[model samples]
Target: MIIQKEISLKPKSRGFHLITSEIYNHLPELKEIKTGIAHIFIKHTSASLTINENADPTVRSDMETYFNKLVPENATYFEHTLEGKDDMTSHIKNTIIGSSLIIPITNGKFNLGTWQGIYLCEHRNYGGTRKIIITILGER
Candidate 1:
């Protein structure tokens, strides 16, 4: 059996937004199924999906800082400023980060590391809603 769901995320800043619970909620529907892997995919170009720390807020903050340093906005060489300085950089950030993620689900539970979590990294500067596609595959 295969299951799919969508989750919406509202990011305040241009950074990672944890979305484990939303993904977890979709897993319960697959309880009757024997066992399979859960694949979480994000449908967007300027944003990305990633698996990161869930324990500490500092981890997220640090990552946010890291992205800033890695892809600083308003670089002199950037000319695609029609949407603002962060436009091209945001797209670049997404390209490197990626657009989808896959996670394993065992015994009807997500097989994640102790501190691991699934996050939707919004590379955009402004806040908006992002959609995530969750797909669960298993045997009924």
Candidate 2:
């Protein structure tokens, strides 16, 4: 079976946010799947999706710091400055990190590691609601 839906996330500040519970809460259909794959694709170029340490808020902060350092805003080479200092860097971060994630599902739960969880990397200072397309493929 294949199920697909678009989920709109609440607005978030510029940071890495753990969204595992939110995803599960939005997709109740996942409970019906005995085994499957959940493919989440972000609709914007300024944000990204990834899986990482879920237990520590510091990890998220560190990730944000690292990305900011790695992709500094208003670089001399950037020409897309009309949007804002963060616009181009946000796109760069999104490209480097990624725009989607595919995870294994078993018994109606994500098969993530003990410390792993899904994250929504909001790269803009005022990134409005983000949209994600979730595609679940499985066999009951």
Candidate 3:
């Protein structure tokens, strides 16, 4: 069986946020799936999705710092600055991170590592509520 759902996340500041619980909250159908793959896709270009350390908040903050240094805004060569200084950089960060994640579902739960969690990499200053499409393919 294949179940697809779209969920809108609350607005968040520009940084990496652990959203594993949020995803599970919106995807109750995951509890019904015995074995399958969950595909989580974010419907935005200025943001991204990834999996990383979930235990330490400092890791998230450090990620933001490193990414900012790596892809600083106002590169002078960016032409897509109509939105703001973060426009081009956000898009670039999105590209570097990604737009979706594929995780295995086992025993009605995500088969994530002990310290691994899903992250919503909000690259823009005001990205607003983000939309995520969750596609679950599996059998009961």
Off by over 4 Å in 2: none
Once model 2 is optimally superposed onto the true structure by TM-score, how far is the C-alpha of residue 39 displaced, in angstroms? Answer: 0.6
Better candidate by lDDT, 2 or 3: 3
lDDT of 3: 0.95
The clash numbers for all candidates, in the given order, read: 0, 0, 0
TM-scores for every predicted model: 0.88, 0.98, 0.98
- lDDT, model 1, position 106: 69
> In terms of lDDT, which candidate is strongest?
3
lDDT of 1 by residue, 34-83 (tens): 67887767777778888889988888889888988988884798887678
TM-score of 3: 0.98
Candidate 2: deviation at residue 102, Å?
Answer: 0.6
lDDT-wise, the better of 1 and 3 is: 3
Question: Which lDDT value does model 1 have at 130?
Answer: 81
